[model samples]
Target: MYTNSVLQTDYPWTKTPLVASAPMLNIAMAPLAVSVSAAGGLGFLAGGFDVSALESNLEEAVHLIKQSSAPIQETYASTAVLPIGVGFLNWGADLPKSIAAIEKYRPCAAWLFGPRSIPDDLRPWVEQVRAVTEGKTKIWVQVGTVAEAVAVAEALNPDVLVVQGADAGGHGLAQSASVITLVPEVKDVLTTRQVKNDIPLLAAGGIVDGRGMAASLALGASGVAMGTRFLASSEAKIARGYQDEVLRVSDGGSNTSRSKVYDRARGILSWPVQYDGRGVINKSYIDSAEGGMSDEENRALYKEELKKGDLGWGPNGRLTTYAGTGVGLVKTKLPAGEIITNMIQEAKAILQQLKA
Candidate 1:
């Protein structure tokens, strides 16, 4: 069976039942990524559709690592790879630019998602990143289905597989199972196929607290990656209104829904058709789905709300509030480091209690 030992070996500095922060666009920037790493959890900075900011972001992360306390420095002293990882949306990413950034920054891992085609589109990225980083950088491919997972494993043989469920926030497959079923199914398929390498699986989607983390481990995940949970982190580069909405919302099952509505309103139409994003429901969604508002009209109003700054979010607010089904569990805005450490402690305690 899969175990945390695989992850501990890959990421020597991390604690057991590894916790990672999902790379959210414009939010999981240098500060949040570095802070998560310092606390012994892997953190990923979102490379987004555009990679122009990647080098500058990595530079800032390097500076932060250098200025970190001795204990944090010691955790990273043994490896040449940067402790934090960088994630990319492959559908719209400029491969050459992304490769250039990875070549220079040499992040520990590259979390890839939303490719136009499986294995075919992801091949060059995997080969080139490995070539440039001399295998120092591990490739992490995200998939929402068992077929996609098996295809990637057979072809790219990625170092890690991030199994994202339908409950996840931001971009993912519109039709996908929850982690409760997806993780084990992927594991079973990969095991049956006898993929040459034992690629570690990291479960993502709807997981907000230590309870979710422990449950994922029980379901055979090597680690858990949380996006919504970190949206409430103090270091997340999110607007006050957006962050406040994330904390204020509850019952993510009913409050959040997956659709391309926000992307259309924001004029970001580059994602693959199969992919959609999960976010808190608001006036914008209501006006479009129920009130029969046109995309053009919604876009216009969204732009107007953007100018309102912190007032643009909430039930009545029109701006997008991308979050997960577990948004209700994320009630506090703690430091990213504290969030990681606390979750790890709580997950361990819960797992121990279950063992007894």
Candidate 2:
């Protein structure tokens, strides 16, 4: 039986980061999130866009969960069911609409990101969701530094603290602490601050597999949060070319830098200055960074990249290849359910051997 307490919740425990993936967007692959939950990991629906999409995904997830339960029942023999959660990029998505959707669907939790203060301007919104959820909904805030983690933990006491490293793909703090160094430090702080032990600690950024999961547990994290790995999975929404790039690119291939070039082009204006995005280095990106190109030229370049394919879709260099350092470990995209099962099995294998 899965011992993860969050699994006991009626809601989903989001198996992977729910954004920018190819398979996840597939309605057929939607069962993957529920599969992760059945395996004792939470699966999150990516709700970074708007209310309608959020509602659609939530409804779809619920449908999939119901749809997948027969197989789970056969396998678990009356065990508690797995939970499914939803993710919203606080920096880009609309909070109210997302919150409303959560209130209506009532997911297991809400994962929020963007470099800003924890217990941020969204506290009331979070509280409102909690009220609607009757305390069923949790808040998993992603942070890059011990200070930020500590701050957020102290203020909101979110259900989970996702400690993201600088190596994490997507948007993250411009210069932040590495996950290896920060997890233990945050664990100590949680102790000194007298936070509840059951409050889970999740380590993100560059985590790829069972080895990474083992490492996170050793570092005092209850579990690991993976984005890049899922992005490469068959259920994600990325282009085939993009998935190939993630696999072919070495772990060091994530040397991709962070910047707001894409944010500007995408028209998401409210992101804080402390953070930037990581993406593949490309010509449009290079041209955007140079400042030599006129606005017309830059826009044209951005459009050109988009036309080239999904690889160049975000902004100039800002195309949405949000992968972490773990991309190197990824050899191919698999079903999200298979990925979770394999990760746990491999970690358990290694951990059992270590006890010997």
Candidate 3:
């Protein structure tokens, strides 16, 4: 009967790591999930955006889990118990398609992000997953603001609520509060409302190292979710040049901005209106307006940039590099497990120093 910092005495996540990899749109695939889970933290295979081959990805998640070097391989069988987590975008996910895949595989958790509807679609989706999962799957939602958190909490009980700040890489809330401000604000709202249970809060954005994780814990979060940090991981499916840029721009987080310049350049016309994409600025950024470049301009830029293929870095890099303010901390492309393990060790060291 020893008290372990990583073990939860609450309703969800009995035992977990201090860090979980944030689910990126097309990048949070099977390999990354299995690797992070095997390393003792939670990881989710992205359930939306490029999900036409979801079944194959789910199958691969199982295969990787079974093949993992960790002893968790035995605990997580090749059954429908869902050894790994899968996430779907609330704004644009094909619910029935996502549900069908989840029903077939039955991951341990389902993450819903980039909200478009709640109380109606969210409630039904949660109920359906519960009915099929026998209430075994944990429901996790990512909200950009305190209001969103309170609204979701009132609608249906969730296992985890992610408070993502504005400094985060990739698409997030239009005008978001920082993690320091947002997580506490959301927690206080939930507490004051006197919800049935004190939902767990996981802080995200600009959390690149153990110091960030430790700080989040001190600020009253159950854990921290890292997106930009993991983008540099060997398992993450991103262009090598993008990873290089992540390391190159460590101290200059201000260089990263929120804009649809890259999205338009790539011909992505319809991202959710309430959200915006964040990443390192490229050629498209300078000439682009606040609303983004015109289709004709972006098309011309895309055609020119596409010719570079893999060498998409430096001053003129035009590819969509979804990242956060912590882009500079990403130094190397290590394996997913190594990243988690090192982060845990670093957290322990930082916490010990604070205690002393």
Candidate 4:
């Protein structure tokens, strides 16, 4: 029975800093959620890619939050935080099951991605989420375009709008602007419409450090939604091989690129053509690109890679490693709480220096 969280609304994050960990399928799990919450940030459970484990994950998130540090413990007594949240992909997949499961958890907010158009295309899902949350839980919508963000911000009672840039990991709009170029445009539109107080803008993509967070704020984003950074968190439920790949490619993050390589390998060709994602440019992707291997061969390679367990990643590894261009900032595999706290501290220092 937690009260309202300081972060659950459009309040000034001047002292508390609003940082959120983006939900990554097969990666963001209970420990990750708890750690983020304990750090006084947003912890969103990954509710997309399938709903089979939704209930268990949400339950585990609660369990971990309860067992976490004092900030989260106080959330249960006061209204400073709701402990955890959940996110879902609404573009190519069905959302009913995911929605149903998360509705019971009563998360602080529900994040929805792939809103082709807002209020109109997203209303039904929003309505369902409202009904389940009794309109108490806030709505956080993610969009890749300024047009989509403006429309959604204008028509809905959304609490937050996540502007995902083309540099993001996982599935993202194939044709989208870079974070630096796109965030300000979205901010201008929202400010012009006078919706800044109602809908806070969060910049997502290639950002994994305090410098990026500070830069986003300077560009008009209220916070940063980081996915790749959390993928390196010690609590992330990713394989060791996956985590290593994330760290290995950290040389200014030039080792990754946007492509549909994983979707093709996994037979997930249903995503709209406009949506593609960034993945680590591994040996398999290079080989498959030159028609040197068949789909069957690629699938076989993926299977073998999975069989090698957590330590099995290299040139021959067939795992789908999604990462951002800013992977270079991810220098270590630290705890999620440590990452959030350090990022906030670093941002504060940078902002202070600029003020000086």
Candidate RMSDs in order = 1.4, 4.5, 2.8, 3.7
Segments in model 2 whose C-alpha atoms lie over 4 Å from true places: 1-32, 70-82, 115-120, 253-255, 265-267, 288-296, 310-318
Best by TM-score: 1
Clashing pairs in 4: 3-79, 4-79, 5-80
| Candidate 1 lDDT by residue in tens digits, 1-356 | 32556677777777767788988999999999988888888889999888889999999998898887454466556666788899998887899999999988889899998899865569999999999999989999999999999888998989889999988998899999999999999999899889845678889998888899888888888889999999999899999999999989999899998888989999898888998899999988988888999999999999999999999999999899999899988899999888888888898898789889
Candidate 1, residue 222: how far the Cα is off, in Å: 0.6
TM-score winner between candidates 3 and 4? 3
Give the alpha carbon lDDT tens digit for every residue of 241-283 in model 3.
Answer: 7777877775646678887676777777566777888878777
| Candidates by TM-score, descending order | 1, 3, 4, 2
- TM-scores, all candidates, are 0.97, 0.83, 0.92, 0.89
TM-score of 4: 0.89
Q: How accurate is candidate 4 locally (lDDT)?
A: 0.76
Candidate 3 displacement at residue 251 in angstroms = 2.4
Give candidate 4 regions above 4 Å deviation: 1-15, 77-82, 92-94, 115-121, 195-198, 291-296
C-alpha displacement of 94 in model 3, angstroms? 1.3
How many angstroms is residue 182 displaced in model 2 relative to the true structure, after the best TM-score fit? 1.1
Give one digit per residue, the lDDT tens place, for model 2 in 167-235. Answer: 777778888877788888888888888865656778887678888887778887877777778876666
* Per-candidate clashes, comma-separated: 0, 27, 4, 3
